[model samples]
Target: MHITVYGDTLCAQVTATAMAQTGHQVLWCLVEPESREQLAKGRPLFREQGLDLLFADQLESGRLTMDFWEGNPQGLTDAVFLALQPGQHGLAAELTKSLASSTSTGCGVIVNQTTGPVGSAELLRDIAKQIDPRAFLVALPDLIQEGNAFQTFTRPDSILLGCEDGEGEALVRELLRPFNRRKDVIQVMSLREAEFAKLAISGILATRISYMNDMASLSESLGVDIDVVRVAMGADPRIGEAYLYPGCGFGGPGLSSNVLALVDALNERAAEPGLLERVLRTNERQKEVLFRKFWQFHQGSVAGKKVALWGVAFKPGTHRVDNAPALKVIEALWAQGVKVTAHDPRALADLGQWAQGRGELTLCDDPYEAAEGADALMLITEWKPYWSPDWQRLKRVMREPLILDGRNIYEPAFVREQGLVYRGIGR
Candidate 1:
């Protein structure tokens, strides 16, 4: 199969490389010249766990190629996947129009991998029908996680294919056959249903996280451990415990955005808002949990203090800090006349860009270096390296041995035994 993926997002790069690795000819049409030049020189614009090697292998094998999107991109392949971001729906519509106007006589499938609002597929189909009625439009919402994207793409739990006709469904299923080896993993549905399903899944995930965070807050007030309650809840057959861990908050490009998108959709259709509105409010408050804890621990004053942050990324295994809790905590601390030293294995460079022109923030290459001379240490992201540290060295370096375990990765009793003050989410 010959396929063309349009966009420069992580989804686009992963789809193009994965398809080429599976023996398909893939043309990755980047959105700009900067991305094209980066890929042309064997450099990836974004970071993923093993995507660099897969991209290099595919490029060297001649199965995958790159080019910038200029104008009409029709007739380049039998299928065109619009892998643009949520805000790029206008570009997607224009590409559909160009493909429909092309002189190609054969049928083509337009796969909507972008997370657009409902009715977007219908809009694309209507535009494509103006030039060629045979152009098939399908909405295939992506379910890729940021840190573990390649594995998720190659072994997805299920694939949703949104098409109105059998031809489009057949073409998409064939294209995804390599990844659907374990069973019949494709779920066929209407275009609107597919679009809504993606948002629905994200909504449920956000609800679970916010629900747990709410419970964690209650547990703290009642002097109960949320971890014990979480374990017992997971043991039940009805609730198999995923996304149940209470942390500072949930942050990424997709999860919260999808929840808000659903909220907007529901609000437009109904007379009043729904429970998802509260879910968004809860998450926003949770993102400030660490900062609030730090302020209270210091008796409502963090002035002239130095704080050490262990991780800056929203989650481990990637350098994305779009809405990370670490950013919020850092900003709050800085505003109160506090200096912050942060270190993450991968997120330092990105965080440096985000923290530019901020005089109080320092980016450190080593976690211990960040801890040196700091008043308190806060663990923001639960990266593997931050799980267990040399407690003796940490105590020796810090001016104050106060530890704010944002992720609850350390034991309270154990840290107390070591003569270090420990605070967790709900312990």
Candidate 2:
């Protein structure tokens, strides 16, 4: 099959590469300057585990090709994928219309992988069918996790497919046959239902995280460990272990936007007060938990203190910092006239760009260097390297030996035994 993937999103890159690897001839149309430059220089558009090598291999094999997005689809393309970012509805619609208007018999499936409103897929489908009777628009909402996107797409637990017609469903199934080999994981549903389900999944997961943060807060007052409670809760057959860990907060382009999209839907319908709004509120407050702890530790004398941050990315294995808890914590520290030095394995470049004109932030190449002369060390993102650090060196270099474990990755007893004062989220 000849496929054309549209957009500069991570999803677009992954889909283009994965499809090409599966014996399809794919043309990836990049809209962003960075994406086009990277591909022209024979580099993967974004860094993901194993994505670079695989994408390079596909390009070398002539299975995957790169082109600029010009609101046009290739004449020989069998399927067109719109894996665009959220809120790019106009671009998505224009591309879909262009593909549908094609006079050739090559264009068949317009896979809508972009996250949008509940009725977005249906709207695209209507526009496509109105122009070309043979064109099929199906929704396969983006469910890929950033850090582990390739694995999740290749070995998905389940797949949600939204298609109203048999021809469209069959074509999409054929396209996904290479990955959907382990006992048919695709769940067929109406277009609107699939879009709503994606948002609802994010909403429920956010609820779980916020619920655990609330429990963590209460546990601190009750003199108990949230980790112990979390383990016991996971042992139950009804409650799985996913998203149960208490942390500062959860943030990313996908989860945060999906939850907010769901909230907007509720507001549009004028629904009664619900748990999702509160869930978002709790998450925002949780982002500041580490800063609050630091302030209280010094008895309102936070000004002119130096703080070291271990990580700033939203999570490990990705360089994105959108809506990351570290951003909120940094802002809080800045408001109190605190100097912050931060280090992350991959996020320093992005963190540096985000810090432009906002305030002064020192970026360190070495994690230990970030801790030098700091009053306290705050572990915002649980990057793998941050899990185990030289406690003695941290104690020696810091003006104050205080460790604020925002992710609860450190054991309270062990940290204290290192001769450093330890403060954890629900310890």
Candidate 3:
């Protein structure tokens, strides 16, 4: 199928490449100009897993192509996927205006690849009718993240298709058939249902993380091990472990904002998600929970404390700092007049000039340098490099050997035996 993906964002490019690599003829309309020059030179715009190889192959084959024009989108394709951001979701209206003056002889179906509110599809459908009442508008939310985008796109857990008619739905089904090689990975539902499902899934996942973090705090107060409690509880087959792993907090705006959006939407309908509200509140406080522990361990004084921090990205696999708890923690520490040195394998360079100017926040080349001269060490991210440190060097260098592990990657007893005050969530 000939596919045209609208937008120049990470999701748009990844979606286009994912389709093209899987044998679809993809022409990307990159509305943003910055990405144009790079993509025009066949440059990999992202550091996703295995995308470079796939992009190279597709670009060489002329199967993957991109355009940086904002004019009327002229294309001949069986499908067009709108992967624009939330603010630019009125793509259907823009396309309708363009279609009035420009002509595209080819017939195609339009699908919303970007997640929006529950009623966004119908709004797009209405605008699409202005161009051609036959222009099919459906919802197919992309579930991929920053680092694992390409891999996830190629092997999505399931593809949810929302359509109004049998004819429009068939086009989407056939277009996405290549990705769903296994029998039935496509599930068709109403547009509203599919949109809510995406938000609902994220909300539930974030809730679990927050719930675990809350319990982890309580575990410390009660002298109970959360790992032991989690194991016993998980064996019930009802509350299996996935997002239940206690950690600092959920990354940024996406999931947590989705939870808030759900709550607001539910309230409008005179319904309430009581547990979800608590979950969000718990998670917000939990973002600071790690720092709170760190301060308490230092006897309410972070001043003059050379604290070493590891991992800046909200999660290990991604370089995104959106709603990153580490950033907030670092900023708070800096405000408190504490000496903070940090290292993130991927996010170090991307932290930008503002973070660079901070005299308190010193960026380190490696983990050991960050840990040097530190009264206390904090683990903000669960990167593999930060997991195991040379205990002898760590023991010798620091004045105060307090290891405040947020992710709980290291064994408590092992670090404790090294003459360090070891602390972790629910340990």
Candidate 4:
């Protein structure tokens, strides 16, 4: 199959690369010149695990090509994947019209992989009908994670195809057959149902995380270890273990934004408030957990102190710092006349760009360099390197041997044995 992926989002890039790998010729069109230039230089606009290599390989094979979407795009593809961002639904509709105008046969499936609000597919279909009634439209919401986007897209747990027409469903299923090899992972449904299902999944995941974080706060007050509770809870066959870890809240553009979109969707449709609003509220407070702990540990005074952070990305294996908890912690520290030295395997460059003119932020390449002369160390993101460090060296380097384990990746007893005061969430 020859497919055209519209937009420059991570989902679009991953979809293009993965489709090309599965022996399909993929044309990735980006309206943004900078993003296209980055791809032209064989680099992904953002960092994702194995994305750089996969994209490079696909481009090298000539199976995947990228260009600007400047004109009509109808005969150029057997199918079109609309992978635009949340607020780009209007642009997607416009592109669909252009594609419809150029197609002499007026045949092609438009797959909606954008994370737009519910009923978005219906709107696109209505718009397509105005141009070419023969053009098929379907909703296929993307489920790619930031750091693990390639794996998630390549080996998705399930694939949802929102199509009222049999032909459109069959076309999408054939395109996704490569990823659904282990089992029958395709779920056929109406466009509205598929859009709502995607949002509901995000809402449920966010609820679980915020629920655990809420429990972590209670456990901290009651002197209970959230880790022990988390283990026992995961043992339950009904509850399961995924998204159950308590930490400094969940960040990332997709998860957080999806929850808010769900909230807005509910508010638009109902008079009553939605539960997801509370989930968003809980996560906002949870992001400040480390700062609150640090404030208490220092007896409400942290003036003129130097703090070190191990990871600044929202999560490991990526350099995305959008709405990251570490940013909140850094802001809190800096507001109180504290200097922050942060180190991440890949996020420092982006973080530095975000922190430019913020004053008192030092981006370091080495973790040990970040720890140098720090009053305390906070493990913000649980990167693999931060999981096991030279504890003795860390203790010797810091001005004060205080460790705030935001992710609870370290054992309290072992950290304490190194003569450092260790504080973990709910432990």
lDDT winner: 2
The reply for model 2, stretches above 4 Å from the true place, is 37-44
lDDT of 4: 0.88
Tens-digit lDDT track of model 4 for 86-148: 898779888877877774533468898988888889999988878777778999988888889
TM-score of each: 0.96, 0.97, 0.91, 0.97
lDDT of 2 by residue, 248-283 (tens): 898889999999998898888875967899999999
RMSD of each candidate relative to the true structure: 1.6, 1.5, 2.6, 1.5
Q: Quantify all predictions' global Cα lDDT against the true fold.
A: 0.88, 0.90, 0.76, 0.88
Candidate 3: regions farther than 4 A off = 33-45, 96-102, 105-107, 271-274, 353-360
Tens digits of per-residue lDDT for model 1, 50-73 = 987898899999999988888867
Name the lDDT value of residue 288 in candidate 1. 81
In model 2, what lDDT does residue 33 have?
A: 78
Shift in Å, residue 270, candidate 3: 3.5
In candidate 2, position 230 carries an lDDT of 96
Give the lDDT of residue 48 in candidate 3: 50
Quote model 2's TM-score: 0.97
As for candidate 4, its clashing pairs are none
Candidate 3, residues 155-192, lDDT tens digits: the string is 77877778787888888877777778866778889888
